[model samples]
Target: MKFDLDDQQRDFASSIDAALGAADLPAAVRAWADGDTGPGRKVWSTLADLGVTALNVAEEHDGIGASPVDLVVALERLGYWCVPGPVTESVAVSPILLSSDERSAALAAGELVATVSASAQPRAVNADFAGLILVSDGQEVREGSAGEAHDSVDPSRKLFDVTATGDGWAADVALASEFGALAVAAQLVGAGQALLDASVEYAKQRTQFGRVIGSYQAIKHKLADVHIALELARPLVYGAALSLADRTPDTARDVSAAKVAAADAGLLAARSALQTHGAIGFTQEHDLGLLLLRVQALRSAWGTPTAHRRRLLEAL
Candidate 1:
């Protein structure tokens, strides 16, 4: 399968990114971090109108029948914008759509928003906005705060301790969990690249010893290392997405590898970026900290490097 985006896809992604940048997420980020309903809700509506909401849905469900690559492109664009909402959860609804017609309707129509718990598969992965939820054991159909959730590391993104949505949706618990792991891993690949760029820029401008810090060997090596790590991890992420898209039998193993690699790269990239900026990167006033927070949260929520390794090794 083709790896790089075709011209059409590239243009589509660029359009989304440009539109999102114009809207600005600062106010929403602040509100969400404080545990309030964020401006992302409106952004989500806007995205829906732009066709992001239905890009991967089947035509019968009012979707565009886009490829998984298309979905990845969309998500990367979202990360670039730092846009937040239940969108990821909404996107994660793919496997469920394969299982239940009702769930498919909710996702495609955008009449519902959902989040999932990393804690369980077929469980409440959806953050309770799901008009219906699927746990491994069974399904529950309901609405609103099905469980407790706290403000996430990325204030704009919400997390939940969701227990049930109260639908009859059934998921292959193992498969669902594996898919979640991979999706988050792919997200980190995009995010880590952004963080690395942030650090490199900081290193060049911030001065030390009568020169730009980026000129120093220490900073240079670190940036180089991040670049290497991201390059290695990035293709693995694309491979996993491609494997999933291809409906390959090795999807789980490929996904696990991608997740572990990308998550580590992301954490290191964030830390290095912070260091390059010296003390200021640690402050909430700067943007690097936001990426750092996202790295920590996504790495743990889906599966740590250690956790993914264990799962992968067991397979071997």
Candidate 2:
């Protein structure tokens, strides 16, 4: 009934955290925001060296073979810096490795990047920086040049539009669809974690009326509410990941709930963070604004809170 990380899982997660913290997120995000090639291209090599790129891939396929808990931990670190890439695709594909006959082989290597199209949309977007694009309803799984990426709310991780060609054997359409949902849920949890951290830190540092703003009842209530949400959402997210990893039947409902809770938590935390910072948080110079933007974008992506809420209610 309890969910926790083992010593190995904690160490791996900590390693990724230390690496991300050392990577200098502010500078990287600033460069990325300025349209500097997705996540400051310079950090990729270092990230790869850190084994972050291989965290979720199968061990037999040359990956570190980290478990779902490990992957979740590493993803949290990635979100802490808002560093971008196909962590979603990578996580979703973890189980499909030996089950597929397509070019998915290169996908497991961690030498390449991959992302699924947001949905069954015909726009045919390739994952930016990803050598393999797992198009969900993609018309082209065939290999081709993944077109240049435009601005994304999370620009540190770029996005691409590519035609799905090649007559590759699509893996279990149903399972992959489910994984997509779970994968996005995982990503949102990371953002939610970051938002929680940002809000807590801001509440302590920002002062108003010659006193720490967090000391006031109103601010105390808001931050406390956010902390409550953090606790509520954390276990659900962990449960969703575990369910997906175990292929449990309740995964669909659990994943959807996790995704919705995470999206709401992230949005609430960001808003709370901005409010705690007051007007200064609105300024472009403050990192709080960036967090706001990320929360906004992430909430809408994968599936909106309303969409998942409806699904959850329907399940009940």
Q: Pick the candidate with the highest lDDT.
A: 1
Assess the local accuracy of residue 226 in candidate 1 as a C-alpha lDDT between 0 and 100: 92
Error of 2 at 219 (Å): 0.8
lDDT of 2: 0.63
Off by over 4 Å in 1: 94-100, 118-134, 138-145, 156-158, 165-167, 171-175
Q: Give lDDT tens digits, candidate 1, residues 1-316.
A: 5457689988988888778877766566566566565475677777877778776566776667676667777776676555655555566545343444555655665656655543433224325344444334333323324566556556555555545444444455455565566667767877788888888887778887799998899999998999999889878877877887887888878888888898889888888887788789878778667777777777775667887898779767
TM-score per candidate, chains pooled: 0.86, 0.85
Question: Per model, how many backbone clashes are there?
Answer: 17, 12
- lDDT tens per residue, model 2, 1-316: 7778789778876777777777776777777656564454556555667776666555666666665556566666666567655555554552352243333344444456556663522222225555556554432233334665655665454556665565554445455555555555555656666766776777688777888777899988987788788678778877877886788888778878987887777777777777777788768677766667766766766667887888889887
